[model samples]
Target: MAQQFEDKFRRKFYYLRLSVTDVCNFKCTYCLPDGYKPSGSKNSSFLTLPEIHRVVNAFADCGTSKIRITGGEPTLRKDFTDIIRVIADNSNIQKIATTTNGYRMERGVAEWKEAGLTHINVSVDSLDPRMFHQITGENRFHQVMSGIDRAFEVGYKQVKVNVVLMKDRNHHELPLFLNWIKHRPIQLRFIELMQTGEMDDLFTKHHISGVTIRNQLIANGWILKVRENNDGPAQVFVHPDYQGEIGLIMPYEKNFCDSCNRLRVSALGKLHLCLFGEQGIELRDLMQEDAQEAELISRIQMQLQNKSVSHFLQEGNTGMTPHLASIGG
Candidate 1:
């Protein structure tokens, strides 16, 4: 693919985290810990489907080959599957994926897979019913579990379980989580808490290191191995006898910014260059006003030039930051 979008640091941008909607079914403690309910952006504030395509096409034209549809629960959007179809039909895009809360799988998984969905990552912090309810402020544990099971039953190229490991919260259940997935083909990933302000205080109270998790896995007879060509941030490993592999994402311990290859466009059309970033260029109005593609690309290029080498979260300060929902986490 020809290169078009490169940051000031010379990082070629080929991945997009597109938040199709800001509405969600549940507010997880780590995501919306403060239970903030921002007044809805005017309906006109969000881009129409055509607008979404224009921005996507601009990025694709500029060499973006991967697009992940995220949400406040993207499935909540009446046209969620259509977004997948649109990106898949774009010949410039090579892969399509989603980070879903996993409630609508039974209704649309096959359709989405047929639409060229290549990967799915489900957020499942706990397997225990009580803790799951406590953490998410809802009683949808069984629903989420069934959704994950259904995802495994599907024929996608990759399906992953995203576990946010926090001390005393879901960290101790690592063994049980692994045992539960011992017979499945899904990848089990334990993620360190991202200090993305939504969980401000909770981060310090429950944070767990990926290194500690790594040591425990080694101590428990799990051997370390590497994927031949995998280069996404997760430190992937596999046990000789386990049916599925494991991953540990140490955002705090490791700096993935040097190789960052993605950018995000929020539901309201803000261009976010980094997850923990405080600034973004406005693009929604340009889209809504029917700006020329050249203008759109120019504005996008400006934001790309503004991209920083690293997010301050790497410094380990747990102050308030962007809300994961609105920021397209």
Candidate 2:
């Protein structure tokens, strides 16, 4: 059976963000915090490579052409490159990307690009070494930069740097970061801090609006030249004299739900229709229980209709835990 994964709102999903592993190397204050340990899910079993392939195949059969592998750090997995290889080998999957912290990227970028990784989104909080260490709780500032350089050296088509801007934390870095990236070819995206219920206090203290960021850029004489990737979350802009484009991911200030067209699968195989949705189908259990591939595929397709129209992720409504690290954001 062939079908498009669409909900009642007729949002056709073609992108899947698969979190290959829940394990991470760095302990960021905002994402992981101090003395943080993820409260384990009921089914804590991670998907094997074969199981991951089956999930990818199922989604591919349902018309998922773009897949982004995410994790606490995707490189922590033993077969990270092989995972991309398997997806690349699939004729149906057209685009393959990954979002990582760039801890081991310098050594792995060449292999990942060779394995069909065309785009990469690395999390780089600030250009200042001390601020970077303060934000990520790691002194690997130079190493992360080196990783991005190597990624460019390998000739990746799109190398995006994701920056989570906060009020007192790194809001001041907006101009500094922009100045540094003005000469580089890397695409920089400043994502608003997501309010995970458990971290509401931190969110209250740190959340910065993208509108303020934009206004600040304009005040600094930076021009917003063009907007591209209408389907994606980033509002990309280019300065006249800059080499790279800048992106603003303002989820709190903007509504991207109506145009959303993606699904997320956790490392343990829970299918998240939307990032803020608390409950999701235990897809791994369903896969293990259903002996017939047709039955599994049919069930998955059936649930696509039940996918929520919007995430309902307003400030006070979020309480789902295990944090973004576990969710692969």
Candidate 3:
């Protein structure tokens, strides 16, 4: 294997989050409240299939074992299944995953699994259909729930559900979420609402710390699971009485970035060293041809060295990120 992808702090990266597009159908209140407006760029500007193949190949060669395809909603891309196949073709890659809105899972998950998708995460911010509709600006709550059931029927052992916890929004439904996952094999992840350049007021109004939930879990006998090298930033907890698990993503917590082990690449082929980094390094030029693999890998490694020890979220520095969907947060 090539040299492991490590930053200056010696955090070896084993996972890659690759965005295929920035277009999303749901007008999530925290993400895109007014709905998705096209950036006026041509759709053809997004990374092509061959470009994706080359990028994945380079990462896999550098000892990256997992790839998570993310997006405003990754399923928006017509060639999403082919994207999975491209990553799966890399023998060095041990896991192929995607984070989706579950709108198409009911109809497309079976084929997606056949195409070698090993893991799936669906965003279900609220359990109450009315509240879900209110938060997501869509009335497809039942449709998304049915899609989750279909995913299980199609043979996914466990599906992760992401809830962006907001004050006075879905925060009161924590008990409901816990009970819903009690008998199911779902890992309910409660992500603390983050601030972005465009959503300052929303962030101030809704942002609640994940520490409160963490304390509740500890007092209730939920055991913290030791993280694997390639795991995402969620602090996974399990209970002996329940079949499901809980994961908390608290970006504002102290030492949160000490275990950073992943990197992101935008749909437009810019490498993001940190989700809140100042800028993305352009990798599209090198990705145009297969012969540029060596230079591509070198550029990635060189950029890794400049990665900061931690993000500046606590200091209110969101960097160039106007919103989470832009970098597949």
Candidate whose TM-score is highest? 3
Whole-model lDDT for model 3 versus the true structure? 0.93
Candidate 1: give the clashing pairs: none
Q: Candidate 3 clashing pairs?
A: none
- Candidate 1 local Cα displacement, residue 87, angstroms: 1.0
TM-score of each: 0.90, 0.92, 0.98
Task: State which candidate, 2 or 3, has the greater lDDT.
Answer: 3
TM-score of candidate 2 relative to the true fold: 0.92
Q: Candidate 1 vs candidate 3: which has greater lDDT?
A: 3
Output the lDDT of residue 69, model 3.
Answer: 99
Candidate 2: segments with Cα more than 4 A from true spot: 35-42, 217-231, 286-291
Most accurate candidate by lDDT: 3
Give lDDT tens digits, candidate 1, residues 1-329: 33489888888877888888777778788887555475455653455688888888878888887888887788888877788887887898887888887878866788888878888888888889899888878788788777766665777645788888889888899778888768777788898888765456787799888899899878877876663221456777777777777898887765667768888888878888877775566887666444566678888887788887787576865433466787667
Candidate order by lDDT, decreasing, is 3, 2, 1
The residue ranges of model 1 lying beyond 4 angstroms of the native Cα positions read: 34-36, 40-44, 218-231, 288-291, 316-320
Ranking of candidates on TM-score, top first: 3, 2, 1
